[model samples]
Target: MADELELLRHANPVPVDGPHFGDGPLDHHAERHLDRLLRERPTISAPSPPRRRTRLAWGLAATAVVAALALALLFTGQTTAPAVAAPRPLLVQADSTPVPLRTLAERAGAAAADGAPKLRKGTHVQTWSMGMSDDKPPITLPEERIVRWHADDSHTEIVVATDPRHPGRPVLGGDGELVADGHVLSRQTYPPSWSDAPPQSPPPTDLGRLRAYLQEAEYSRTALNTGELLHAVATLLDTWTLGARESAALAQLLADTEGLRPAGQVTDRLGRRGQAYVYDGTGSRQMLIMDPATGDVLGLETTFTEAEPEYGVKAGDVMSYSAWMR
Candidate 1:
């Protein structure tokens, strides 16, 4: 294998005791190198040609491409890196019979404090989102965002390009290159401004009021199904970190609502253990993870149930995953 690779490289090799480098991902930089290799091949097109010659030229061009790709795949094995946005599907297997949502809700309600906690502003979250464009490879973008309000109403927001799932490891640079972990993607401070809108404003602690508040703000309807309720939970967590009372209220609301089935326990990307509830939609499945003790939201992940060949995404590919932290 060493002799074969050296023949392909047309370069010198080190001693057998040299340090080993593992296989690397075909990132953007590697793609550029492949493009250069293909371009450097001799030109094969012509203004006009006979049918027989045209067929032969096309065949030769195809052969050249296959050979080049084979070499690239064979030799680009120096350093390991994740090529796509998500390293793997975060699927959790059920260990036992599904736990009833009502039971968990009761526990959460019992753990609530007597008084309502003050209105909390903003959120700190980490997310992995997968996206693709026409004729391009699919990529995932991992980001950590924190939006906080300060005294006098001014707010500051910070976004970092990192995936807690693979701490200290290089992350796919949304565009395909690999960047160092914890790289600061963006930071901004906004002038003092406030809004009294449903989501922008703090949520309610009463179960009835909280349900109405979530429906009107997040669901855009008076009545909600289990899936919609889960969506509302996700949307709510995007803004505020709920207090004990708020979480208890939300848990009771979900417990009263029908259709959410418990999946069992699972650890989120942030390495926090939470209970999993799944709601299968027509086109996708939503897995909502929450703290069993407090009923606060932990994470929400979506995976498509159908294949999207046009986008190079399979049925089990994660569409998006977000983990919340207090």
Candidate 2:
């Protein structure tokens, strides 16, 4: 894999005006100094594109001037960085005997009656995922990720891929480079967007208001039916730290939603026993496992119930499965 730090440096650049560097050859001593500065300070400001006149002024000796400009830009704070891409959303699937939705909702509501744990200032989630490739013996590219989101909208995440063939072994990148076994393979931190204000409180817990809130929030950008709504709700729960009221409200909303059929009881991938709920739609099945007593979601799994030979995935093949914990 590419060096994570190198990628980060390229992603965060400082904006500057004019051609700060001239065309003259750089002195070896100056070059060494620039290299040392870069090594010691990874967060140097980036230079902006030079104007036509400025470029002409720099002439053919721009190479030497570039080193000096680098130093100047590093001291000046004219930086402009690119936005990081949002994390991929989770998918869902299931196949089992169907349970009454109300029963599950009531259980969840009862659990909520005890009140939710105190909400933290930031969102923190850890997940383990498998099934990305279709190798000869079926490679389940097992990976783990930890994501954190601060109230300011800034975020950080670390992802590690493990060798599926050898449990606990770190997988080597395509270039045959290996991060020390059990070490983080990649990490990224994004600065917050000052324009976006932080939310004053958690999502509403009332059924009506919660539904409306979701519709207004970006979460409802795509039209969602009952089953899809449940899946989205599960995703929200995974992404945010909700209080007991919010959790119970969500359960009640799901209870009232149409198309949710219980898939009996089963132990989730995390070995937690919970009631299984399945939603079938257009060749795909989504299953959610939740604690029967606490209403806390245990796991989510999505499977292809119909064949799609073009993708090399057969019917009943797991599309993706994720287990999240605090």
Candidate 3:
């Protein structure tokens, strides 16, 4: 059951490395394509996670935690990518006022390109809905998870856990040229038994096989773990709001958000009237919805990775997710 849930959770979403950081290796070509679009367009929609209160809180806290760690990682080591030129886009003028999508795209691109670590970092707390086996549970490392990432021409290094208790104890891996050079790193959760499965019926459908591909490709850990769904949503919205055509595939994603459901009439705290893409999944699904016009995400739903007889996911269940480019 646990394996099945994990399989579907990861089947369609971006791959994630582990609990903290992910740097396996993604489709650089595909990422570049998305980057090109964002760098040339003026407006785009931002991504958000399911709106369940528990889940929404987890997502926001996770992002805040990672964002803080990213700043630290940036100061320790610089991540450099080949500089690419910006693209040209159409501009319109009305009543002596001119605006170009190119400008928006450039600003977004510069932000991404800069990728500089912030000089001043803020403290953010993260809460997780963790579940382990009945007989033996997965151990929580400690408070203040320190997630770190390093990307160079050769490899990407990701480390989790930096609190005083376990100072530098971390799980690490890399991909791209590192794998090409035949440097295979061993798994961290020793004995593989750390993630054992109970005797159960048949596994999930073939659709679940996609997870193996995402894992092999090395997507960001948060993306696969359901922690970064909102980040992806925000990125999408950022693009869509800029006048980018909304793809049907992404519309479906909006539909599945845990809190968003079709309604005859809907308005947010700000009183904007329109169909909102909200997270509506169980376990605090009411908090992720917000006024799409303003791009304010307020909540998240919870998903515990480990097995639990009482609260965690069970076997024979099916989970579906969709990803898109605006």
Best by lDDT: 1
User: What is the per-residue lDDT of model 3 for residues 1-326, given as tens digits with 9 covering 90 to 100?
Assistant: 12212222232112333232121122455345433322332222232221211111232333443454465457646343111111111111222222122232233334333333221111111112222333321222211111111121111111111112111223111110101111122111111112122111111112233233223223354234322455444322322221111222223233333444432223221222222232333432222332222222221222222334553344312121111111
Instruction: Report the lDDT tens digits of candidate 2 across residue range 121-235.
Output: 3332223332222321122323444445546565554455432223333333212233333345555555653332113235677788777665544345655686567556655
lDDT of all the models against the reference?
Answer: 0.62, 0.48, 0.25
Please estimate how well model 3 matches the true structure, expressed as its whole-model Cα lDDT: 0.25
C-alpha RMSD values across all candidates: 16.3, 18.2, 20.2
For residue 27, model 2's alpha carbon misses the true position, in angstroms, by 57
lDDT of 3 at 193: 15
Q: Which ten residues in a row have the lowest lDDT in candidate 1?
A: 48-57
Per-model TM-score versus the true fold: 0.71, 0.59, 0.23
Order the numbered candidates by lDDT, best leading: 1, 2, 3
**Per-residue lDDT value at 4 in model 1:** 20
How many residue pairs clash (N, CA or C atoms closer than 3 angstroms) in each of the candidate models, in the order given?
1, 22, 48
Which residue ranges in model 1 land beyond 4 Å of their true spot?
Answer: 1-87, 114-119, 174-177, 219-222
lDDT of 2: 0.48
Candidate 2 local Cα displacement, residue 147, angstroms: 2.6
Model with the higher lDDT, candidate 1 or 3? 1
